[model samples]
Target: MFSYLVETGHTVEGAVKSLERKLADMKLQLLWKYDVTTKLFEQGIRLDQDYWILEVSHPDLTKKMLVQNQWSGFFLPCKMVVFSDRETGKTQVGILRPTSAFSHLEDPVLRDLASRLEEQLISVLNEIEQQQVV
Candidate 1:
């Protein structure tokens, strides 16, 4: 239940959109997103800001992960979340690092794959964090 969270002045929607756009440049795909805010609204609960889960993936990398270990499918598509605080209106984005799960195994190959993916994912987040709010 942790996120490598970053606070930003950008709107939550804008932040996520920016990251989605950036992913292409990093050779990653913006697979899907779950709009938590919208879902909550449907449930009759209103939030001051926004929330979402952005699923990201890379074809070659993902295939390689599977080749390395089929069990690694669970962490194939990395999950990144963006949110804005109700009172502050400040946006934030963070990811559940996949390396955490991969590192648990004693296999050097799996750990290496995790390290590579972790680096790339963190790079995306770091770049997005530097983007100026619109």
Candidate 2:
């Protein structure tokens, strides 16, 4: 399982809908979507394959954390690892796969495929900007 934190580019309602369509097109099942503003987490219609969580959050909030501090994608909690900073003052997040499995996947094909799919999805969202009614 490869964990990726994709920047949705925009955090508006329209962006969320666009992302939903893009994910469907990519064949990645929409597991759930969390709305930070409303504190609501809705379960999406199940698809046939792998599950994905799409979260819509303000880029500005992340930007502030990144620019003001020396943080990268480490702050967010990933599906593979549950991390809490306050209690231990240490990061618990680690690679999604076991060390051996992760190390074994050294081929460029997987990377190329992911890049192509991401670019295609972003392009689709850039063209349509409206509230998604799923």
Candidate 3:
């Protein structure tokens, strides 16, 4: 599936924080936070870059999906990523859209859920600005 990437003016850290704040306002619980390069740096592995992943889950939706298809677990808890372009101090935000996960699921209900998530994700992304770096 093609990525839903957005150019953001905020620094990588700022972008993630903004997204988290918006998600909280929407009542979405953040499930996990992964700092890719940071982890590697801790392990003495140099990445020479910055990357982060955030996962959010809605309890009710997750349970309903489990009852319908266990496979849906793979897509449960929406995820978004933030990565930096060191040279420009700009950040890029993206997600693997939930609607794309419905490709072979064959369930209208799930499709509806994904559609709603797609909207919410877009909504979240819309709240952040891609600032012009001078």
Q: Provide C-alpha RMSD values for all models, in order.
A: 2.0, 15.9, 2.5
Instruction: Give candidate 2's TM-score.
Output: 0.33
Mind giving the per-residue lDDT tens digits that candidate 3 earns over 10-56?
87887877888888887777889899998999899998768999887
| After superposition, candidate 1 runs with Cα above 4 Å error | none
Candidate 2 backbone clash number? 0
lDDT computed for candidate 2: 0.36
- lDDT, candidate 2, at 130: 32
| 65-127 per-residue lDDT for model 1 (tens digits) | 889888888776888989987677778888887777676556688778777877888888888
Q: Global lDDT of each model?
A: 0.81, 0.36, 0.78
Quote the lDDT for 24 in model 2: 62
Off by over 4 Å in 3: 86-89, 130-134
Q: Which candidate's lDDT is highest?
A: 1
| lDDT score at residue 78, model 3, on the 0-100 scale | 80
Cα lDDT tens digits, model 2, 6-77, are 222233454445566654665544455654333323344433322223432223333443454333234322
Candidate 3 TM-score versus the reference:
0.86
* Candidates ranked by TM-score: 1, 3, 2
